[model samples]
Target: MKKLTIGVVGAGIYGNYHIHTYCCDKNVERVVFCDLNEERRIATADKYQITGYKTVKEMIAQEQLDAISIATPDPYHFEPAKDAMEAGIKYLFIEKPLATSVKECEELIALAEKHGVKISVDFHKRWDPAYNAIRDEIKKDEDTFIRGYMALDDIIDVPRKWFTWTDKSSPAWFLGVHCYDLIRYITGSEVEKVYAVGNKEVLKKEGYQTYDNIQAILTMKDGSNWTVENNWILPVTFPKSNDGQLVVVTEKKYFKNESYRGVKSFTDKKESIPNYIFMNFTQDSASGFGLEPMQEFVADILSERPFRTSIYDGLQATRIAQAVHDSCESGKVVYL
Candidate 1:
């Protein structure tokens, strides 16, 4: 077997995870980090004991990469992804909400096809066992309405201090895209239309030009509906970084998953709900759900099998998210 070399763009939170996961794989020969931030690039490289570059172009020029993962911020995915595919990287894995715009997603799909490269999106929610059960149950019934609320908030430090590009994204792109993809995965339906409303009061007051909250009503092609609510304005003291649930109602059965209530911990300083379903480091490597989806891409590349989550899946999710943004901007329903 030929050892595969992998490179990661953006040495941030998820970028570091990709590095960690790839390092644990026996088939991977080398892993490199690329980021515009010199501090983060050097720090992550030093932490992981890997080479680092200041830009994707520099990394690709120097390393013969077999695969690449794009973990850049939401709005900054298109360029790195395009470069990776055009560089003839065999496999490309990207964080969710494939791209900020529908046009970008379409172009990426076309480019991947043109290059004969395999592409997968990191919508890791699909690997959750509880969600998989829900998807199975929903697949059994054709008429099911899903009410999903995924409210993930970062401490004020996230937008106010962490990244300077918060204005380029919103809760819809940052958080809602996950919900949209999960709903589509569970229901096995495409979003036919979307109606959304958003407000920007809190973040704007803090000098960030982005939506603090958004509520979107999505009508699926199956005629069932999903209501998704997203808000990222939680205070710095919020117990958990994310808290949400999914409820599927049908004529014959009802299913609900209170993801946050599965585990709990509290202390004098703050409360916390450890995310055991996805990326639980307490267990062995194979037990973690977070890395399974990315591993699927690796397996597909090595075995020449089909990817579990195709580039089309990423494009469809991006389409619905882009529609939500359009509806929010136009203050009217957007038809897909």
Candidate 2:
């Protein structure tokens, strides 16, 4: 058996997960990361006790890495990914949406092929046991699909405080891509067209130039329709930072699921819902469907297995999201 050395790009919130996840994997011999922020890089390096670099080029040149993971912001994913691939690392596990634009996604795909690198996009929703159960049930039946409704929302603080790039990312790029990818994974279909509408008042009032909420109707190639709603302006009083609902209606059966899986807690300061299934990190371990994709990425690489999702899956999701935004701007249906 061979152990692997891994390098991670971006050392922010989600980037920390990538760093911690690879460190926890038994087959990964070493884990290193790069971040442009000197403060974050120094802190993360001291905390993880791993070498940190200022640039991907520095990390690639110094470390004999077997793979690299990209955890950059939604719009900035392309540069780090291209840098890693062009540096000759043969495996990658990228955080969602691949890239904000279809052009970037296509370019990344071409580069991956030319370099013989195997790429996996971290669309972790596919790892949810509930969603998997729903997919299994639908597969066992011979019924025609009718419609689906999905809405994913984050607390207002997400865009207002969590990131400085809120203006560069809308709800469609952040939350909507997860919904779009989940719909495709569940139904084994592709989106054919989209018509969308959105409002920007909430974020605009706060000086962020982006949509507060967006709703899009998707016509799938399988002839089923889906309505996806995404927003990050939920009131702070909401128990969880995020919440969602999934409902599907087929010819003979109806199914539903919610992000809150029957768990709640109340405290003097506030009420809360802990999504233990999504992600839970203890002193020595990390577990959850949310973190499973990273673990699987290392295992699959060592075992030479296929990834659950590919660059093409990332490309299609971006295509749908781009169309959704286009429709919102043009006030008309956009065919894909």
Candidate 3:
């Protein structure tokens, strides 16, 4: 097998996963990681036992990297990615909420186009096995309402810098973007507009800079409505009612990672899973929600295949995210 050289541009909590999986990957020749935080960079480098760099420029100039993962803070995505494209990396996979603002996000879309680099956003939900089953289920049956949710209470305890901001970004970007992207992908359409309301009062009193919880009514192209609720205030250990309840909908039919009928071998459980709906699926497969998808994406690039989350996909998600922000900002229904 011809191994590829991969580098990481961020060493934050998220970047750790990319580095770990890429380093152990037999197909990866060498791993290089970059981050400004010296301790994080050094610690991750030491643990992974791979090269580390102070800046993206340093890494690009030093390593013959075939691909790079842009896992930096939301505000810093553009510069590192711009550098990687200029250096002619064959592929760039960015963790999403693509950029802090729409303008920067558009520039990224344009840059990747001009440079002809294969790019994908890490909308991890797309790769979920459960989601695949759910999609198949939706096609096989009918549902009046599909309710899916992600919560604030289920994540880590971080500083206000980590969330609660209407200025740089928020938990919506951190959390809601995934739900938005998933809803859009499963629905096979783009989000038409977002009408959302949020409560930052509790966060404000806590001296937090952003909303504590937000719920939005999203209109999709199919004329179907989807609801999204996200928060940073929910306890990380919150008990989930189903599939950890990250995904839930009406009893008629809905797809969730927790419940789906296999398409290959007919199963008795299709009728067994609660709130069960007839869904077509086969072989429970690893959704590649992690390093696995990254590897498959590399294969797709090698085979010249289409990537699921193209630059346009990221930009579209960005547009929806921005609209959600608009709805929150202006206290009015935001038009697409």
| Best model number under lDDT | 2
The residue-by-residue lDDT of candidate 1 on 121-160, one tens digit each, is 9888888888898778767756556444444445556667
Among all windows of ten consecutive residues in candidate 2, which has the lowest summed lDDT? 277-286
lDDT of 2 by residue, 108-168 (tens): 9999999999999999999999999988898898667899999999999999988989998
Model 3 residue runs over 4 Å out of place are 141-167, 236-288
lDDT of 2: 0.93
- TM-score versus the correct structure, for each prediction: 0.93, 0.99, 0.82
Alpha-carbon runs more than 4 Å astray in model 1: 141-156, 282-287
Descending-TM-score candidate ranking: 2, 1, 3
Residue 187 local lDDT, model 3: 68
Residue 143, model 3, lDDT:
57
Question: How does model 1 fare in lDDT?
Answer: 0.81
Backbone clashes, each candidate? 0, 0, 13
Q: Local distance difference test, per candidate? A: 0.81, 0.93, 0.71
Error of 3 at 122 (Å): 0.5
